[model samples]
Target: MGGFEDREKAFEAKYARDEEVAFRVTARRNRLLGQWAAAQMKLTPEETEAYAKSVVQADFEEAGDEDVVRKLVGDLTAAGIAIDESTVRVAIEEMAAEARRQFMEAK
Candidate 1:
């Protein structure tokens, strides 16, 4: 019983840590994507930082990545940048992969 309880506790702890890492990676990816978009829009440094934070917050608007994609596409279009949803989605996937790699390397 003691061994089983210890194993259960370890699994719970591992699950929590994995969740935290996933959250951090997603946030980092959003920031990277925002900065990429901001650069394309030629935003100033202050504006870029704010934009990045906005991208991170955009994730909370829904359960999936659509919210972030919509925000990026709309903002980029409004800024006169030629962009499509498919392109933005591809960028998101690439950025997410990069973000995961970076987090893994840092660990």
Candidate 2:
């Protein structure tokens, strides 16, 4: 019983840590994606930073990546950039990998 409880506790801790890491990775990916979009739109340096932060905040609007995708697609199109959902999806994957790599490097 004691060992069982210990295992359960450890599992919970690991779950929490994993969730935190995933959230961080997602946020980082969003920031990178935002910067990429901003670059495509030829935004100023300060505008790029603000846009990146806005993208990160956009993620909190809903679960999954739809919110971010919608925001990016809408904003990019509005800026006269030719982008589509598929391209944004690919960027998300790329940014996610980069984000994970950054985290791993940090550790």
Can you give the TM-score per candidate against the true fold?
Answer: 0.95, 0.98
Q: Write the per-residue lDDT of candidate 2 for residues 1-107, one digit (tens) a residue.
A: 99999999999999999999999999999999999999999999999999999999999999999999999999999999889999999999999999999989998
Best by TM-score: 2
Question: Where does model 2 exceed 4 Å of error?
Answer: none
Q: After best superposition, candidate 2 residue 43: deviation in angstroms?
A: 0.8
lDDT of 2 at 57: 97
Model 1 regions more than 4 Å off: none
C-alpha root-mean-square deviation, each candidate: 0.9, 0.6
Q: List the residue pairs that clash in candidate 1.
A: none
What's the lDDT of the predicted structure labeled candidate 1? 0.96
